[model samples]
Target: MDLNLIALIMGIVEGLTEYLPISSTGHLILVGSWLGFTGETAKIFEVFIQLGSILAIAVLYRHRFYSFLTLAQFQKKGLNLLHIFLGILPAAVLGFVFYDWIKTLFSPYVVVFALLAGAILMIAAQLAKRKVTAESLDQLTYRQAFLIGLFQTLALWPGFSRAGATISGGLLLGASYKTAAEFSFLVAVPIMFGTTGFDLIKNLDVLHPQDFGVFAIGFVTAFVVAMLAVVTFLKVLNRLKLIPFAIYRILLAGVLFYYLYF
Candidate 1:
């Protein structure tokens, strides 16, 4: 297959899945498995393009991050960024330790299982109507942020779906759906950025000159599409429920099983 074509497909997958509870990693696994196996180049591409999505997240939430960087100007904004960083810490530690083992899960069958399991959890959360939000309005305590980071680590599994894990973990920990989703997105910035950065640094040897064109195209494509997705998701999420995505996951799982088995 053409490298540009693969980049385009994966870029669309990233843009669409980065926000939704449907695993971006899972889709990338399936797509790459079908098109190109996860070798050095593919792994590099997969990881770096995620940075593009992370860039999108930062842009969409620019105000929050800016206030965080320029903390002296806005005390409240600084605290918000503080909590977000605190929320990211646990996952960063886990990811650094288990990086190689975690990378091996990007396969079609694994992704299928992840999509199915994650969807089921989403369904259950919707059914229960439970709610939990951080008790402190000032800033999330270290404990709360740490717990969310621990939950974020579960997303290391390709099918496990970071959105699914974080959101479900939040619910399990007594968080409201809205809070869970919001926090999940907030914490994702670091994880995605780290993944992209680490992969690029490690795979610099295999990245040929020609690869840059496709990678750049894919990164920009992912950024544009993902920014639009982020805006659209925040808008619709409040008014809508996640059941539709659950059904979509189940259907996707069925398709993956069929493809893998037969």
Candidate 2:
């Protein structure tokens, strides 16, 4: 396949899956493997394109973020920058510590099991009866945010999914689906920016001048597709919820398992 085509395909995959309970990294690894686009360059490309999806979230939630600039908004009783920091803290620490080790796990085999495990977790969280303490993002507590952060560490393993882990954690901690999803999207911005930026800088020597065109194509495509995806997902989240996504993951896992091992 042409490099530009690969970039386009990867951009679509990243944008579609980045914010979903299905893992974007997992999908990228699997797709890249099928396309024979493996190696360090592929890894860097995958990470770099994710910034586009994160940008979409930042844009979609611009007003909410804009509110952070005001002292009065900070003084009000609700979700704030502190909550976002707490949500990001655990994964950020662990990811930085185990960055190299984690990279080695970016295989389709790991993704298959991860997809299955994450699906089970989502299903369990959905079935488990829990009190809804935080129906809105505003009602979320510091402890709950921290616990969600802990769950996010699970995503250090590709295919586990940052959204799946954090959202399930929120569900288990008594937050409603909308609140969990919103919070999950919100916290993704800074964490992804930090991680992707770090990866880009660390791999700057690997980048060729020819790679810029491919990277730019993927980046722009992800941003545009992600904007549409996020909006559509939010509109239907309450009605369809996590179960549907879990089922999709399970089915995908089974297909990949058969393809890989059979």
Candidate 3:
């Protein structure tokens, strides 16, 4: 395979859409199809690029992550970690058990539906925003976290972006936009890292040292791009409304529909 070109394409997509409400997986799949990247390779490319977004959030939120682990924030340090682990457990289980079937569902047309459906949900979330609590994730109950986890499982289906589903779930469950968005970003680290690590293990025999270099380039590129995405999104989100993103989703889906038929 042409590693450099692959790195460049995946890096750009990973950087650009990883933080947005739009399904990053869906965009990668669409880009893959347009570029003729198919089968296992395409899935590998998509999953690997996801690591970039995860790393970006980890770096950007390093202070929060450190505080969450330290004695300063927690009376019982070990217990805090356990809660985080427990929250990640459900998604991990689901990923392992249904991994193959989930990837098989990726298609451009499904992305169109997901984009449109998610937009409608975003609009509804906007309306519902009035009733939501302004509670932070630290104030979140365990039951609420588990509910978000269940909602996250929906993202395993193509088009239902993980961040999109989780954020909407959080909002509906009473978390404010800032809290929901921040926690949603934090949860991504484990999910993406686990996914990338597992794929690397399964493909170890096939991955030569040069493949590692290519992966590194793509990983670094994705990280840089995602950092920018994270920063810009936070700023835009704080000052503006989610209506802009909702509109973007509708417009993108409309374009996809046109492309589908024309």
TM-score of each predicted structure versus truth: 0.87, 0.96, 0.85
Ranked by TM-score, the better of candidates 1 and 2 is 2
Clashing pairs in 2: none
Model 2 error, position 56 (Å): 0.4
lDDT of 2 by residue, 1-262 (tens): 9999999999999999999999887788778878999988988899889999999998999999988777876778998888988999999999999999998897888999999999999999999999999999999999999999999899888889999999999999999999999999998898899989998999999899989999999999999999998888888989998999999999888878887997
Q: Rate the local accuracy (lDDT) of all candidates.
A: 0.76, 0.91, 0.74
Question: After superposition, which runs of candidate 3 have C-alpha atoms over 4 Å from their true positions?
Answer: 1-6, 71-73, 76-79, 129-132
Cα error, candidate 1, residue 261 (Å): 1.0
Query: What ranges in model 1 sit over 4 Å off?
Result: 36-38, 72-79, 132-143, 172-176
Model 1 agreement with the true structure over 46-162: per-residue lDDT tens digits: 777888888888887777667667647444332365677777887888788988987777677788878888888777867775545553323345566667778777677777788
lDDT of 2: 0.91
Runs off by more than 4 Å, candidate 2:
none
**Winning candidate number (TM-score):** 2
